[model samples]
Target: MSLSNIANDPNKRMILFGGKGGVGKTSISSATAIYLAEQGDKVLIISTDPAHSLSDAFSQDLSGGEVIQIEGVDGDLCGLEISPEKGTEEVKHMLEEEGVSDELNQSLSMLGLDDLTSDLHQNTPPGMDEAVALSQVMQIARQGDYDRIILDTAPTGHTIRLLSLPEFLDSFLGRLLKMRVKLSNTLAFFKSMVGMEAEKDRSVEIMEKLKENILQIREDLQNHTETEFVVVSIPTLMSVYESERLLVALTEQNILVRNVVINQIMPRNESCPFCSARYHSQQEVLEYARQVFSDYVQTELPYLAEEVKGVEKLRKLASMIFSDA
Candidate 1:
């Protein structure tokens, strides 16, 4: 399960890095994206985290939610930071496209339900941000612009919601479509009785388009050969515990997870008593992780003296992770 496998596999189009924050996820994911791009694969490394660090990691600004070509790498690499506002607006715009909104409004107006339009815009779903973020990236994958996409997600909670969102959204929208269909049917019965005509089912049209957006990502998510979730955690108790819970949740959602990176392992130093003590302490946690995540490929990253901030430093980190490749 070397990352070389992901870089080489035609089906492995997406590699998602997720875990508790501050576990070196941003650095690791960024480095992996660079490594893949360096391998002659066009790569897009995007973050859906509200608090974005891609700009810092890449030493460039990726703010504004627009894709920017990364300059320092010879390999093709692009970056984007999906803000909550952008994600919400993307979903809103998707729903409103193809005259769906006009038809919806016309139907509502005909049914004497113009008030529901305001409610539709006001009502917010739980994972609207995550759902739209995923939808946007998946759309790119389906379009085949990049050979691989490295998804640097928010913390574990948000990512878990994202994995589960497709199913939840499907169910949610299915219910709304059902209600709309029933209401329209009822109206049709009355209209027939009055020798009038029933309006077309615009809700069905809208829901179908929304459902199409999730289909590709949802299928790729469950297909382990197509996508993989890499869990990153430090050699600490709390991170280990959270990683375990995250693993369970990912299992529940049927998302594929094959790699676990134990970042920031302290190196032994006999001269420094503190380093020696912490090094031994970290080994215990590492051993626990090796046993707990034995089912997955494990990579240990030694604590570095310098921050993994620049392209060269990121290259160093990537070598440590994918030296064999």
Candidate 2:
């Protein structure tokens, strides 16, 4: 498919750009968001990477958890850089509201067990950022406020971990729920002997809600028509290898990959030995990519003299990527 096809596809509300670092994923994602916004659609481009480059790409100071509207765009274009630390804190607050922390502390105190409330406040579990980011995406998708949601994800490994989280969490939580059920039954048996009632199953409710959210995310991801994964890479052997791995992983998950963008292609210059050598090597890699990913749409972006920073440069980049050229 072409950029126009992606732009005009009604079902493509969630577009994700991911690949190895230094491959111009941020540039492409930002340009795509700008292209969509310029086409008269409201777009929200979010960076889930801990090391954010969206603000740098736009040449604007876009820090904090709030979304800031991009000035000068004819249509609505907003950007958000998610802070993983802040996201973990938000998750803590949500758990507090759900009474998870309170109930766990109370139950542990009664049983003379080690208190986990302090530990929970001290540290967020590993991969919490991906979990929280997924939740944020789900929230934005459900709101229907923006015409399109473009995600500039982290490097290949991190993005794959994020994509696989729903399934991992669903199964893990299922086991936890089962254990909680057994615990509840045991507690009820003891309470009955003393003619007292067991407490309500708040843990069960929380786990069930957690499971439900995971299922919702899984459904949205598996809806191939509505979600498109755009893999970005450079015209290099290593980049092509990583992109191929990403394609296989996404295919295994049954997620749809609409495009593979080969960025930073060196222009042919036979007079310059250095450029000529690089161009020839890049051609071989490109051919390999074309053969490997024959079923998917592929696009090449010429190497620019300067770095792609600021809205003007991004607009120019967008034109190149989206145009029929």
Candidate 3:
């Protein structure tokens, strides 16, 4: 499929740009959002990476949890830089609001669950940032406020973890819920034998709802018609290998990769020896990428002298990425 076709597709509601760091994922994601917005679609571009470059790419000072509209754009284009710290806090606040932590603590008090509950709130796991970010993404996607939601994700490893977190959480929660249900049943049986009434456990209901939300997000992610993954890489050996790994990981999770963008291609300027040598080296890597990702649509972005920032530079990048020529 052509770049224009992918960009203009009505069914493509979510677009994810991810690859190794320093491969221009942020710039490409920003440009794509601009392109889609300019086409009259309301677009919101968000950065899930803790080290946010979306603000830098757009030359705008965007804060966490707030969407800022880009100036000089004819269409509606908003940007957000998700602060992982803020996201973690928000997740905690949400659990508190839902009384999940409190309910679980009260229900499991017999088993010394206070420590576990404290650990949950105090000690976040290694991939908790990504988990929080994914939760935020799901929340935004469900809001239906924008025609297209563009995500500029973290580097390859984190992105893969983020993509797989829903399944992991779903399974983990299921097992926990089962255990809780069995324990509740046993307790209720003992209470009935003693001629006492047992109250319905609300923790199970909360777990069920959590599982439902996870399943819904997973479904949305796996919907090929509505979601698209774009892997960005430069013409280099390491980049090619990383991109291959990323694609394989996504494929394993049944996520459809719609495109592979090879950024920073050397121009065909053979006058200089260094440029000539770099071009040849890049061509070899490019050919390898073509063979490896032949099943997916591939596009290349030329190396520009100036760093791609601000509206004009991003517009030029968008044209290069989506242009038929």
Say which candidate scores most in TM-score.
Answer: 2
- The full ranking of all candidates by lDDT, starting with the best, is 1, 3, 2
lDDT (tens digit, per residue) of candidate 2 on 1-325:
3577798786799998999999999999999999999888889999987676888899887777689998766678999988766777777777777765455565555666433345445554445577678778879888999889999988898877767776666665665555456556767797899999866646557757766776787778888878988999898889999999999989888889979898999999999999999999999988898898788888889999999998889999999888872
Q: Best candidate, lDDT-wise?
A: 1
Residue 77 error, candidate 1, Å: 1.7
lDDT of 1 by residue, 165-203 (tens): 667767776766765776677777878999988655455
RMSD of each: 3.6, 3.2, 3.2
TM-score of 2: 0.88
Supply the global lDDT for candidate 2.
0.81
Candidate 3, residues 1-325, lDDT tens digits: the string is 3477677687899998899989999999999999999998999999976676887888878766688898877799998888877777876676667665454576566666555456556775445677677768879988999999999988898877766766666665665676577667877897899998976555557656655765677788889998988999999999999999999999987888978999999998789999999999999999998899898888888999999999899999998888972
Alpha carbon lDDT of each predicted model: 0.82, 0.81, 0.81
Question: Cα deviation of 36 in candidate 3 (Å)?
Answer: 1.7
Off by over 4 Å in 3: 93-128, 186-201, 269-273
